[model samples]
Structure formats: structure tokens, C-alpha cells
Target: MNKLDLKVLDKQEDFFIINGKEFNIGFTNAEKERSFNRNTEEGIKELNSLKEEFGANEVIYLKQIHSDKILNYIENGKSIKDEEADAIITKEKGIIIGVFTADCVPIILVDEEKKVAAAIHSGWRGTYESITFKTIEKMKKEFSINVKNLKAYIGPHIRKCCYEVSEELKLKFIEKKTEIKKEDLFCGRNLNLEVCILDDLKKAGIQDENINSIDLCTYCSEDVKLHSYRKSQGSYGRMFSFIILR
Candidate 1:
């Protein structure tokens, strides 16, 4: 498996204001052992430390099948084993919703007015199925959240500079988004997953300015110590992207 080059940074937290309410969003660093796999005792310890550090009442995780499935946590309640889904949404506060990713996009959506939050795991498959769009629609239906009041924070993932895809896969994306230029999708065999996701977010009715992307490519950022599954040749430790309502 690939290992993350972990580092401790001063500005590891991302703060957001929704409806005048402030929430702190954090992504785990590669500096420490932060995997959630129960097989590794260290991974479990690291996750516990993180929960204590954040003072979160509960940390929710999913099995992550890379589909468009979105779970409503408030309705289903917590689970002893990780649930199988690509996204999770909740209106309950003090509970942290998280998704694990190495190269796939980990996206957080917050409805400032409704105090509703969602975490989505969008790999190529999930993105292809419009998981982000589905998550937003569920939030709107369940929490009555307006699109205008939603803010999105896109976490770091593999970028076009390092993410090469098959021609067959490229054709699939083109089929879904006919308006996208062929050149934008292909960086000489690499697919720009970030662009595809941002386009989807806009099409889902999120304002351009409201979408905050970390813009860091995990495969390209060896200095900052983000994990890249491709870089490790499929052996990579997953990073957890989490958000909670306080």
C-alpha cells in the first residue's frame, strides 16, 4: 500500500461561515498515521486521537462503493460497521461525517441556513453517476436546503497532471457532459477530474464563488505530503476528509 508523507502544518483547518454560523472543517495530514482500517491498531489509535482532538460526538464513515448512493444519517442512525455508500448527509449537529480517499475527490457541502452538511466520495465512477448532484438533491428534499445557501469545499485529489485515464473512460465522461471540450478532458492521456466535478457543481446550481477548492493535487504534492494511490502503484493509505456541525 502507498503511504502518506505526513506533515504538521499551522493552517490545517478550513473555516467557513454559513448563515452567519461558523464551522471548522479539517483534512487529516500525511504527517501522522491516519488510516481507518481496523486491521491496523495504529490506524484505530490515530482515528481515536482525531475524534478526541475535534471533540466530535460521533464520527461517521461509509464503506464507499463509489456509486451515487447517498445515506441520510439523521434518519438511519449510526452504525457499528461502516455503511456501504458514496455519500452521507445529515442535519444533526456534533456528529462528524467523513469519507476516505486517496486519489478520489472528497467533497463537503454545507447548507448554512439549514445547518445541514454532507460528505461525498466522488471517484471517476461516482462523478460519472453525478453523486455530488444527488447529494445536493437529497439535502434539498430532506432538509429543505436551498441551492443558493449551500457552500461546497472540495478537498485535494489527484489532478490531470498525474491522473491518466483510459480512452474508453474518457468517452464515458464526454457522453455525460457533451459541452466539455475534448482537450479539457484529456491532458495528453490524463483526465482532469477536478474540472469535471466543478462543472457538475455549477450545473447543480451552486454559485461559482461559493465553491472553495483546496486546489492541491495529491499526486503532485510530495512536499506537502498528501497520499496518491497512483504514485504508490495502488498501495496507498487513504486520507479522511471530515466535517461536523458545532
Candidate 2:
């Protein structure tokens, strides 16, 4: 599905990160002809490797629908896997929760003190709905997490360099988020979706330094083998952004 013009890496490109000894996070690369969707043979194999590599017990996935709905492992438990949601959050350890994305943003939120982590799939729709801010609010209410302790890692997505939008869409977004000036959202015909997310995070009390953004643009990156939906000529595979409390 995801067409790669460049030579594939000889091995897996592990974008692994460790936040002390509390958790492990990773974003898989499209270096190999692999898919992480559940029940697929390729997905199963790749996830097995992920479970082993991250020392996680079970891999958590959901029927993602690009909505702002959030699944909580503590309140709803594991059965929420069959549900449709754009975000998943939990304080439970040893289980890996992940989201699949091509050009859409995948966000990982972690509170080291509360040992709670969340994975959010924020496409333009979810960003417009403020899914990240809602996830943080849920985590705080459920687990009593301190917002200042939350570290948000925004995964790779289509940036403004290549994200061209229509005037009507820009006007709609500006109308919804009155606080955001027109100039901040648009660079000529291109729109920066991350600016809305940053504003949401700041409003939700996530500190500036605590927010980590992967500056790679999925649509135009020459070095990284990322799948981009906007660049998808019919079919485009998805990359995995996962986190586990170790």
C-alpha cells in the first residue's frame, strides 16, 4: 500500500525512547513492507517484536474512527479494544497501547508521577475537536495526574511545508477557535494543524518545555520512510505510535 521510492533499511529503524525507568515509547518506521493493523499476519509479527522489545505483555489497539472519543483502560478495562475511538489512556503497566497513522498526528502523553500514559490519534478532525486536551482532562480526573508532570510527544505528521488547505476549511477552523488568529493557522494556502494543538495543550496546562514534537514532515521527508496519506496514490500504509508503562 505504502509505496517507497528509496532503498529499504537493512534492519528495523527503532525510534525508541525511555522516560527514566517508568515507561517506554516507540514510533515504527515504514522501512519494511509492514502493517500494524490487528489480525494481519504482518501486523502480528511486527507487534510480537514490539512486545519483546518494549517488555510489554499485551498490545492494545482499537477500531479508530478519527473522532474525539477516548478509551480508558482503568474505567472501561481491556474490552474497550473493540470500540471506536481516537484516543486511549491508562495507568496500568505492562500493556502496550498504540495508534496507527499515515499523515495524521499520533500523540503520546505520559505522567511519570502518576504512571499514566495516553495515545491519541489527532488528525485534522481530532485536532479540531481538541482530543489531546480532552485526554489530559480525563487522565487528571481519573488518576489525579498533575498536568505539569505530563510530557507530550507529538509524533510525525504532515507539516505546513506541504499541508495545503482550502479557504473554506481555514475559515471554519478560525470561526471555531476564535482565540487563534488567522495568520497563525495559515501560511498562504497552507495550514499548520499543530498550532491549534499547541494552543490546546497550553490551555490544558501542559508546559512549553514538556511538549516534544517530532519535526519530521511525513509528506516531504526524504530521509525517513514515512507513509503519507496526502501522498498516497490510491493506497498508503500506516505507522505505529505506541507506549507502555514498564
lDDT digits (tens) for residues 1-246 of candidate 1:
111122322354321112225455666647554565434687666556666777777777777888999988863554723668999888878777788888999898988688889899999999888899888888878789999988888878998888888888877888887867878877777888877777778888998878877757888876457767888787647787878787
Top candidate, metric TM-score:
2
- Angstrom error of the Cα, residue 93, model 2: value is 0.8
What lDDT is reached at residue 61 by model 2? 75
> Which residue runs of candidate 2 sit more than 4 Å off their true CA positions?
1-12, 16-18, 75-78
lDDT values of the candidates? 0.75, 0.81
Native-referenced Cα lDDT, model 1: 0.75
Tens-digit lDDT track of model 2 for 137-236: 9999988999999988887889888888888887778788888877888888788888888888999998888887777788998877788878986354
| Residue 172 displacement (Å), model 2 | 1.0
